[model samples]
Target: RYDVDAIHMDDYFYPYPIAGTPFPDDRSFSRYAASQGFSSTQRGDWRRNNVNLLIQQIKYTIAAEKPWVRFGVSPFGIYRNKRSTPDGSGSETNGLQNYDDLYADIKLWVEKGWVDYNLPQLYWEIGHKAADYTTLLHWWNANNFEQPLYIGQDLKRSVDKNELDVKIRQSREMSFVQGNCYWYGYLMLDNYREVYDHLRSQTHRAKALIPAYTHMHKGRPAKVKKLADVFTEDMHFLTWEHPKQPRNPETAQRFVVYRFRKGERVDISRAENIVKITPDNFFVLPYESGKSSYTYVVTALDAFHNESKPATIKVKL
Candidate 1:
């Protein structure tokens, strides 16, 4: 798990098909039907059970390895369409549901303390005739338990009316949500400039550490124990060290460098400007003249995405 911080399982592993291809599940289905007494009409139910098992297993894997680390899953926008069942997740559109189509029992995963957080991909807006943002927001709110809840807004669909309502609701949800995860760190790139505007603004991401995952484990980094070195001659290099985070350190994949630019804490989130580092529980920033004009800090993020508070270094001018 050290390969990544925060298990960002997107709508992958099993993708929805194109017009010609079918989701090849005959072998799994036959086995499942034989083992669980599942009938053809009940295939969706069996599939859901399978996904639940996967979630539960992964949860145990994290617990056994590093309980405090974080886990996240970005599911399809619709869990279930209203017309399909009595307890349908009433949203617009008769689309494939995560609960039914993909077999992911997302809501129950949260209620049962299996997943650390959930970022439902609600790309539609409030006024949308189908799959309105308000509908899913309320639906998610009603079911939130000990875990965190975040909305995954899509950048491509951002400029559209239904997508814009998502931005409005995103702010509103924060009062109730843990945080919102922008779909792909890159999608909010140039292609989705309008939607990117909504996220890059100063008004967004107002919190530090989106509510703690109480269900996983509450672990803190050992303190910013020392600032070892600072260089400023040719370029600049600053180094700081600390003990491992609460979870097993191996699960940490990368670190985010934070610089106190004129007292404003700035994290390099852009692709071109950003520097990647191994999640070794230490931060080393190569000096850049125009980078910033303040102190520097470092934080560790594990594969399950347990982020440490900034370990600061004040650069002497």
Candidate 2:
């Protein structure tokens, strides 16, 4: 009984083209192509069909089990070059095309709603000749089949302020482009090139809720049934209870705690006002004041991060 939230596939569908070595799928194709109604020259089409079937099958199986779980794919940034496929390619680069070279129909998968999100590995810098990051970023953002778009960023190249600043500006300017994820985990943990400090102080100062997948599951979670607070010797703890709906995809999977000054407006959507997002019902607040009155609000987040109405409680410490 392992609970999984998301399934992600990277850009290894078909290996990159070497100089002269073939991919060596001939035997498998010969065995199944005739029965499946494909000819010898239709090897490319059959291979693409095989990958497409696997993609759709995985999506359906995940939906049948847990509708909230998302299936995402990170394909090579260059789907096709305009020179090769006039009708299919949009970008101006001559890099290896995922559709033609790798036999991966990534655009089709996104257009058919088989994948929840598409994160293209647009890892090059802005002025690169072959695979420009800026060019590909705009290309994918414009063609996003109405799903969330997050780019796979390169930490090494983005260490330069000029490069990172441009990426940050473009990512924020594009409305559909949600965010970007670093390529590797250790780079972030090790703070390689002080990239972590720059992110913490500038880009990620406050916590934010993940973008919701509204197409999979919509509507707000049910409000909490009880909200109360308790005070220890030097710590403050807030506890809550919600109506049970374990199997319902719209049920609360977590709670967001918001704290406000007595006279300040209690805006739960504001990132600065949020204290924490907790899986458990209780949260421990920082000991800021002993004689201050605080207004706290708790909201429920469903499996897809759809938030519910707030339940407010005031405490005078």
Candidate 3:
């Protein structure tokens, strides 16, 4: 079986409502209502219950098989508007609500601890008339209900001067925002407006480990052993014996390699020095001949990516 890290579902729950039209699920609903202990009169409620059952069952199956595999959803940005659910509506946006319109009770799932994380699609700009990005960001952040919360960003808008910058800045400023999930990865890769370069140079200069979920798998992996530096084909490669234990919960799933300049102190905690997160025990050091000597450190990572104590070697260029 493949060992996947996480399973994510986006805003594909119930369809966004269309004017003067209703989704046709009556035949299936009527067929299973009595057997499922619900009534035909409760059609709307039945539909919502069906979606809930599906989400919960998926989570249960994944957890039973691999407790470390996370399950998350990216629902529509607005849960409800002030007019519809005055008590529970978290924002001023009048856009479609996942709760009322789509019958996907995202808040209940988060409140009941059914999801590992929730990434709502807050795709509008800062001052849009219907759904302001800033407004929905705070709304989602406040309503996370202890579950990890990440925002779904519109990557196409990232080229606009103040748009991506403000979104990233605000995310960094907010304590509840775990991170962001960019929409349309290909556009960023195509370097639309040089967004990729901008991100690499400024916002994301270093790699970060996915945040830990301590409740599930809470231990570090064994350290790398017998690390050695070898030069081959004009490339400096570091190969090491894999951690003694390699498959269980506490065993190494991959390795994190960090490289520091000769005079600088080696720090595994900082992401700037990190060269790679790889499954192989060997890593090619980013060394230029005639340049300063570099110190390299390698650490093992468990299924949950908890890093082990480092094993280090200093090499001359």
Task: Give the Cα-based TM-score of candidate 1 against the true structure.
Answer: 0.63
| Higher-ranked by TM-score: 1 or 2 | 2
List the candidate 3 regions with Cα displacement exceeding 4 Å: 1-3, 34-42, 86-89, 158-162, 230-236, 244-249, 286-293
Per-candidate Cα lDDT values, in order, are: 0.62, 0.86, 0.82
lDDT of 2 by residue, 1-317 (tens): 56878999999987888989999988899899989889988988888898899999999999899888999999988988878875855688879988888889988998998999999998888878998888888888888876889988888778754577678788778868998888787888999888889889988888899988887777888898689898889777888888646677789989898889989998876898887888889888666557889999999999898998999999875
Better of 2 and 3 by TM-score: 2
Each candidate structure's TM-score, on Cα atoms with residue i matched to residue i, is 0.63, 0.92, 0.86
- Model 1, 1-317: lDDT tens digits are 46334555676535564668877888889876767878877776777787778888888887676555566788787777878767654554667777655767777887887777788888775656777777777767666663577877765566554455447555465545766666556766764656656655643533243344434545643434475555556544555564453446533345656555576645544222234445454445554565456655666654334566666666643
Q: Which of the numbered candidates is closest to the native, going by highest lDDT?
A: 2
In candidate 3, residue 192 scores what lDDT?
Answer: 82
Error of 3 at 50 (Å): 0.9
Error of 3 at 136 (Å): 1.2
Backbone Cα, N, C clashes tallied per candidate: 8, 0, 0
Top-TM-score structure, candidate number: 2
